[model samples]
Target: MTATHRTYPLDESVDAVIIGTGAGGSPLLWRLAQAGLHVVALEAGRAWSDPSADFATDEVAQSKLYWLDERLSGGDQPTAFGANNSGIGVGGSTLHYGAYVPRADPRDLRLHSLQGVAVDWPLDYADLTRYYQEVETFLGVSGPSPYPWDPARSYPLPPIALNTAAHIMRRGCDTLGIKTSPAPIAALSQPYLATGSEHRHPCVHRGYCHQGCRNGAKASMDVTYLPAAVAAGAEIRPQSFVTGIERDPQGRITAVLYDRNGITERQRCNAVFLCAGAIETPRQLLLWQAADSTLPLNDAVGRNFMAHVSTQVWATFPQPTYLYRGFPSTLITEDLMRPDDADFAGGYLIQSYGILPIMWAEQVARSRPLLGQSLVDYLMQYPHVSGLGINGETLPNADNRVTLSSEKDARGLPKPHITLTLGENEERIHLHADPTLRAILTAAGGADLWISRRTAHTIGTCRMGTHAKNSVVGPYGRSWDIPNLYIADNSVFPTSLAANPALTIMALALRTADHFLQQR
Candidate 1:
C-alpha cells in the first residue's frame, strides 16, 4: 500500500491534518481514512524504506533513529534527551521502543480522588476499557490472561517465551514472595492477520527491540498502523516538518504550515490533530503562541510535564546469563505499583531488562568517571551481568515543563527547553524500591550491584482536564478554545502511569479518533 505524496505547489487541502506518524497519529489516520475522511500525516523524519538495510544492531549507527533536535535539559534532575526517551522517523518512538504495552492501572486515573495528590483524568479506566481492548486486539498484544490489576479480558495472543533473564528474575521474585507475570508487549508471539489484509509476523526474539525491527514483528507504526492508514487512503508525507499552526481571526485552526526539504507548503484543513508526542506538541503550541499572542489558548499548554522516574539495578551472577538473547524485557512484577499503603504518592513496577554493551558502558561512565583498566574490568563482566529496572510514577509539577528557549534550530524556531526535577514523592519511591530490588537480586546469587537513575516515557505536557483554563485539551482531546483542534498523543496524558505508556497512548488515540468520527 502507498500514499499520495504532495510536493511543493503549496496548496493541497484535506479534511484533517495529523502532525506525527507514531502510535498516536498512525491509528488515528487509519481510523479516519477508514471512516472516509481525507487525512494527511506529516512526519518529520525519513521513512524506513528498507528496514534490513537501514537498521543495524550496532549502537552508534542505530542512534540515527532518535530525535536529535537541540533540546536543553534544565533544573536539578536533567533528563538524558534523544537516545534515552525520544525517537525520530516515520514510526516515531515506536520504532525504537521495547514494545512493552501494559495497560494503565485503574488507580492511575483516579490519582486525585484516591490519593488527593495530582489532578485526576477527566475520564477513567471504565471510559477507556473498550478502546483499550480494541487497541490490544489490533496490535496482537501477548501476555498472561486475566492480569490481576485489570481482569476483564485475555490477551490476543499467548505470551512471549521467557528467556534466561526472565527465569533468573522469576527465581528472585519467588524468593521475595512477589507475584510475577509475563510482560505484556505489543510484539506478536505468533503470526497475526490484522484488518484489511495486513499480516504481521511473529517476533524473532533478537533482543534488539530498541533498534528498528527488521522483520516487521514488533508492532511499530511503520509495520502496522501506518501501512493500514496508507492502504485506507491517508496521505503520509515523510520529511515534512510542521513549523506552526495557522489560526484565523476567531482563533480557529484553518491550515498547517510545514517545510519539506527546503520548500515551504500549506495544507488547508477543517480540523487539526496534534500527535507530535509530548515535546514537539508543546513546541508547536508555543510556536502558535508566537503567531497570535492575544489568542486565549489554554495557559497550561506546556505545563505539568511528567516522565516516569526510571532506575536500573544491575547485578553480577556466578555464571554467564546471555541476557541479550531474546526480548529485552520479559518478566514483570507489579506488586509495588499501587499506592496502597506507601509513603509515596504513587508507585512503580519492576521488570527484567537487558542492555547492550555500549548502553551499559555509557551508563557506567555517567555514574562515575571509570576510565583506563577500571572501565575494561567493568566491561569484562558483561556475560555475568543481569538487571531489573523500575518504572516509577512521577507527579506532575508545573515547574517541570517544556518551555521555548531563546536558542533557535535550523528551521529558525526557538528550541524547546525541558526542565524536569524529581519531587520528594518520586525520590521516596526510588529510595524504597532500590533496596527492595537489590535484595531480590542478592537472593538470586548476585553480587556487585549498581543502580543508575534515568527517565523514560515523557508525558503530560499538554494535559487533558475538565476545565478549559487548567488544561490544553478536554476529555475527548478537543481543544477548549478551538473546537476543531485535537490532541492524540502522550502529550494529552494527565498523569504518568507506572506502566509503560505505549499501549495507553494508542488507546487514547483510538478513543479520540472515534470522537472525531462521531462529531463528523
Candidate 2:
C-alpha cells in the first residue's frame, strides 16, 4: 500500500513537544505519552511502510522514501561536508536503514578516561544497559549473547539462522583464527512475545530490509513505538516543520512554533524534546541562537562531531552464494573493535550483505565491471561471490563539526556545512582494518577482493557530556542552556561506538526517557 498523504494543522498547546520521528523521537514519544504527558511529535517527513514499492530495485528514480527529503542540507553550508543522510518520513532514518542493531561495545564508552582522546561519557555501560534491554524487548531484536568476538550480554532473543554467505564467512573466520558471530538485527528471527501485543513473526530473509519491511518483520519505529505512542494518546503531527523554539525572558521553553506546509502555527508545551538527528538538531539550535539574541548557548552546540569512518571490501567467490537472498546483514566480527591499547588500531565489526540488483550494478559500474552480461557470466560460473565492509569508530574532534553554510535553502535557512577529516587516531584505526579485512576475505575463499573508502553512518555533532561548557546536552540529555529543552538522538553520543548506531540510538532514547520519568 502507498503511504497515505495528509496535512495536519498544528496544535496550539501541548504538554511536551518532540521533534523528528526516527529511532530517537519515536521511542521517546511512546515513553513520554505512556507516562501520561500530553505530547506532540512533529515529523518533517510523511509515514511510509509499504515495502513493495520502496524496496531497493532496478528503477533509476526512486520514491520519496528512497532518500532523505528534509529541508535541512549541507549543500550550501560553509563547510564542505556531505548532505545529511536520513529519511524525512515519519519513521525518520529508520525507514532506509539496514537494521543491524549491534550494541555499543563497553570499551567504546571509556574513550576519554582510558585512551585520553575524546571526553568521557558521564554515564557508563552499566547505567544504560537496562534501557538497552528495554528497547530490545520493545523492538524484538534477535541475536545471541556474547557474539564470540567480544564481551557478552544476554540477547532478549536468539540469533537468526545464518545464510550461506554468513556460513562461509564463519568458516573463513574459523580457518583464520578470527572469531565470527551472527549479526545482531532488529528484525524478528522467530515469533516474539510482547507484554500486551501479539507475537511478531520471523523474517523470510528477503534482503529488502532497507526499503522498509513489508511483512512487518523488521521492527521499525512505525511498527513498534509509533503505534504504542498513538495507543497512549500521543498526538503525532506529520508534515509539520518546526522553525524555532520559543522561550520567555526567564529562559524556559514556552512553546514550540512551527508551520504546516506553509501555514504558521504554535504549540505551547511545558517541555521540548529535540529528537532530530545530529545534523538537523544542531542546525536547529544554531538557527535559534542566530535568530534570537537572548538564548544562552556556549560555543559547543555544533562542535565536536564524529561520523564512523567506513570502507567496503568486495570479493568474488568460486560458487553460487546468492548473498542477496537473505537479510542485508546477517553476520559480523568484532575482532577489530578492541580497546585503544590492542595490537590493532581500535576498530569495529566487518559487515557483509547483499544489495539490490541495480544498486549492485551501480556499484559495479562505479567501481568496476561486475554486473550485466559479465556479472551474469561470473555468477553462472562462480555464484558464491560476496562482499563485506568495515565500520570503525573515528575519535571525536572539535574541528570535525557541523556548521551553517552561506547558501540558503528554498525557505532561506542555511544548509548544514560539514568540515570533516579523519583524525590521526582514526587513520591509524583504518590502517589496521586492511590486513584484518584481507584475512577475512581470504579465509572465505574469495579469489579477487576490492576495497573502497565510503561510509553512510554519520553521527556525533551534539554530544552529551559532564559539563555543559563542552557539550550541548547534560548527562540526562537536558540542554544546559535551555532548562525545559532536551535532546535525544545519535547526536548525544560523546564518541561513536564500534557498532551499527541504530540500537545504540534507541538505547540512548530509552535511557533518556527513564531520566525524564524519574523527574516526573
Candidate 3:
C-alpha cells in the first residue's frame, strides 16, 4: 500500500474504516494503522494538501473550509451554523479553531453526582489525564510549564506570546482579583517534531487564526495526525460523504456507503468508526434506524444535545487593542468557572477573544443592528476594541436535538435539523456572570459595550454511558447495540464542558483508540 495516499479495493474487507479525519477519526486512524490494522479514513471535504495554496487570508475566501450545507437551526435560542464555529474540509473544525485547548476539570465529569443535573460521565478524569498529556505533547501545545489552573499537568512547549487583547484582559482580571493564566493552545511555540512526521512550525502571530492558519503552526489535523496516519499506511479518501451503512443478518456493519463526485461507492470493512461529528453522527444513526426498524438502536441515539452558552461582552479602549493581532484567545481565567455559590448546575470559564475584520464586522452588524453608517461607525473602533467571553455548560436536553428534516441533501440523505434552547439553569449561569463580564471590561478602561449570546461546540448527539438504555455508545465509544460499530469524536462526549471541546475530544479519541488496541 502507498503510504502517502492509499486506496483499498471496494471488494477488499478492511480491518477498520473511520468516517472523519478531524480530532476524532484521525487519531484512531493513526493508532489503528500503527497497530498494523488495515484502516481507511473517509473525509467529507477537500484534501487541502497544501496550506499555502489551499488557504486564503481573506475571511470570505477561507469560508470554503466550512460545512455550509443547508440545515435549519431554530429554537428559542437557535444555534447558528457555518463559519462562526462550524468547520469542515480535511482537519475538521481544528482548521479554523482559535487553538484554545484546555482539559476538562474533574468536577466537569461528575455533573450529576456533584450538582444533581445531567448524568456523570462513564469515564473519569484519571482515565483521561494520561491521554490528555499524550495529545498535548503530540501537538506540542504552548502553555505555562505547569498549567496554572490545572497545575498537576505540564506543557511540552512554552506559552504563545501575549497580545494587546490578552494584556488588557489580564489587567481586568487582576483588578477583579481573579486568577488568570496563559491559555494552553495547540499552535506550537517553537519548532517541534512529531514522532514520525517533520517538525511543525510555531505561530507567527499572523492574526488569521480564525480564518484558518495558512501555516502549520496551528496544529490542524492536516498538519498533525492525518499525515501521521497516512504515513503509517492508513488510507484517506477525501471528498467522500458517508450516506448509509450496510449490516448483515447478525446486525454487524459489513459495508459503508458514500458519495464521491456523484458516484456512490461502498467499502467493505470489519468494523466501522463513526466520527462524523455531533450533528452528522446522530443524523446517520437516525437515518439508518429509520430505514430498518429492526436495528437495535434506542432513543438515546439522537438525544441529549448540548452546547456551551457562549455569552460575550465587547468594548472599546483608548489604546488600540488590535483585536486581530496575535494568537487568538491567548489569555484565560478559570477562577470564576466553578462558583459554588451559584444556583446553576454548572459554571463557565472566560477567554480573551479576537477575530478577523470581516467576521468581527458582521458580528457588530447583527449584535448592534447597525446598517450602513452605524456599521461603519462601529468599524472605526475596530482597531481599539476587544472582546471577552464565557463558554459555560448547558445542561443536556433531549429537546435540543438533531433530527432528520423533511428535506434531503444532494446525496439523498435527510438533512439534519438541529434545535437548541437555553434552559433556566443556563440563563441563570449567564445572568450571574454577564455583570462580571461587563465589569471586567469597565475595569480595563473599556467603553461602549455590546453583549452577545450564542451556542458553540456542537456536542452530545451520541453520548456515552454505562448502559445501552441510557446512551448510544459505551465509555470507549463502542456502540451498545452494534458490536463492531464505534464512535470517536466529540459526539460521544457525555456533556459539554466549560472549556473548549477539541482537546478533550482528541483525548477521548486517544482513549478509545487505546482501548481498541487493547482489545485486539
Highest-scoring model, TM-score: 3
Relative to the true structure, candidate 1 reaches a TM of 0.97
Candidate 1 Cα errors over 4 Å, as ranges: 1-12, 339-341
Error of 2 at 399 (Å): 0.7
RMSD of each: 1.8, 3.9, 1.5
Write down the TM-score of every candidate: 0.97, 0.89, 0.97
- Report the error of model 1 at residue 244, Å: 2.0
C-alpha lDDT score of every prediction, in listed order: 0.86, 0.74, 0.85
Write model 3 residue lDDT over 1-520, tens digit each, in one string.
1245766898999999899888898888988988888988988998876787777778888888888988888778888778766778878888888889988878989999998889999986888898988889888899997878766788989999988888888899889898889999899889999776567778889888877887799988888888888888899888998878899999999999998887999999999999888888888889888888888887887777888988888899998777677897899888877786787877899998876678777778668877888878889889888889888998888888899999987666788888888899999988977888898899999999888876778889999999988889998999999999999888888889887899998899888888988987
Q: Candidate order by TM-score, highest to lowest?
A: 3, 1, 2
Q: What is the lDDT of residue 210 in candidate 2?
A: 64
Write model 2 residue lDDT over 350-376, tens digit each, in one string.
876666555555455556656578766
For candidate 1, the per-residue lDDT at 151 reads 69
Instruction: Score residue 446 of candidate 3 by CA lDDT.
Output: 94
Cα TM-score of candidate 2 = 0.89
Clashing pairs in 3: none
Query: Which is the better candidate, 1 or 2, if ranked by TM-score?
Result: 1
Q: For residue 514, what is the lDDT in candidate 2?
A: 75
lDDT of 1 by residue, 362-456 (tens): 88888756799988898888888998888999999988899999999988889999999889999999888888889888888889999888888
